[model samples]
Target: MEVPPSPTFPRALPSRSIPLAILSFLLVGVISLVILPHDFRLQEMFPSSCTNGAAASTSGQLADAATQPVVDLRVFLGVLTRPGMYERRAHLRLAYSLQPRPVRAVIDVRYVFCNLDKEEDRVLVAMEIIAHGDIVVLNCTENMDGGKTYECSPTSPTTTSARPTTDTYYRLAALADTLRDKPRDGLYHGFLNPCHQSRETQYMSGMGYIVSWDIAAWISAREELRHERGYEDSLFGWWMRKGGFKNVYGEEPRMYDYLDREMGEGVTCFRHELIADTVAVHKLKDRLKWARTLNFFNVTQGLKPSKMYDVDRLNSNMYHV
Candidate 1:
């Protein structure tokens, strides 16, 4: 069969139309510049999602809202735990509930664990999930020193707190303020291992750590981390080093372990007595540690005068689990 050649149109625009075309292009560009925003922003793109009607009711308030950049950062703090630790969860819930909510930021506390094995866990955990709806079940078996943390990375939670390893009995407001200044991407904020060194090998302690959302996303995208063994924190450090990510180590008396007076007054870089400005306290292995830590923070200061009984007599240090 004979094939017909397609008609060839002019490759260039007409000589006379060139000036008109350029004028039209410039007009369109100017119109676009006038119509479009000077800067792209979440609020400008999706005003309804960014601002609540109640929040920006007044014209002045709305104007202020329009001027201000909307931050979409949410801190997902997941506490890794066994599904059977109902009492511990309850305690944690109480501890978190007592904290003042962060301003202009969401701090969601999620209980993370592997699949439920025991019948008690299945039942109680399901109940807890129904009541709270803040539990995360990873696709792995329950075991410490396993790749559970690696498994959790895909979930892309932001930070950790109020777990068995540490007692975060500090002001959430202060934390929120601190977090505001934190780098949005490529940051690992916590007490780094080998506090004296700023090397790549240094890993944030498992006691608690904070990874920005971008870092979490980067971690989730890597498949090699799934099979990596050894300490989860160390593996995370390795991964960060592999990716050339940055670490923001919280230094000295600011971020330290809970100093057991009974364990002697010997102090190191990471472990020391509680100070006025503590970001975190690690090694809260027992109820006594938590009690002492909480007491030190004056968590019970709001307790009103009661005729029932005096809370003053109850020594928090005496309570041990």
Candidate 2:
């Protein structure tokens, strides 16, 4: 059979219609920009599963935390623990680890560690785990790198006081506020690179960095995030600063090495801002040091500034677990 000829038009679009087509494309782009947000809010970053405490049926409080109103932030504190430091954990729980967090969705402090080599230690650790339900055994490494992955939970939480405004918290807020009021649309919607001049100037302090469960989830999901040069703080700071959450970092300074003794201030820090807005206190090893710290805060021994109580840490360091 013979083939039929088909009608054909010019290959190129008419020049007269070109301007209209371009205008339509530009219009669509503009409309899209106007409708979609620049970035997802920090509060809205977590998955629905994070808020669903069905996985925490054994925990009544956890279930409540899940059903509660939208949380501004949920902080998960990872306290490194090991075999014979059960007393330390007890001191912490009695001192301040058990305080209720204020104005937040959730605040859970977990005693994180790995499996023990000895059968006896393992047995003790297992008892601690079953008794507290606050223990997290990674079984992967003795290092805390794996713990960076934890972000949410329910029940007999790490149970620390509310989010202690560490330098990071203050910095996050300042950066956030700056981005919100910036003249430009913002580099990352709500982030402005405060350290654009020197990348070295930007970093988060790992000692006491408070982050939303959503942000934690995001960081944990990325498997490639690992330590280099064996400095977890430097790497963590770098990861967070460049996590696209903010261009610069903030320091919530209450995360002191020790309230007073660690900094050589010797009871002086108790009167400083570090005490008032305090969140996390690090470097307190041994039963004595922990006891002193607990006394210093509880004002069981010496004089405190706010008339809250008299706290002479040197004199009041008698209690222990």
Best by lDDT: 1
Instruction: Give the residue spans of candidate 2 off by over 4 A.
Output: 1-58, 67-72, 97-101, 143-199, 213-218, 247-249, 259-274, 286-289, 299-321
- The top-ranked prediction according to TM-score is 1
TM-score per candidate: 0.69, 0.51
Taken over the whole model, the C-alpha lDDT of each candidate is 0.49, 0.35
* TM-score of model number 2: 0.51
Query: Model 1: per-residue lDDT, tens digit, 8-55?
Result: 111222112110000000000000000111122222211221222221
Per residue, candidate 2 scores C-alpha lDDT tens digits across 101-139 of 344334443454445777887888778666656665543
For model 2 the local lDDT of residue 61 reads 41
Please give the distance, in angstroms, between residue 188's alpha carbon in candidate 2 and its true position after superposition. Answer: 14
State how far residue 120 of model 1 sits from its true place (Å): 1.3
lDDT of 1 at 177: 58
Clashes of each: 0, 13
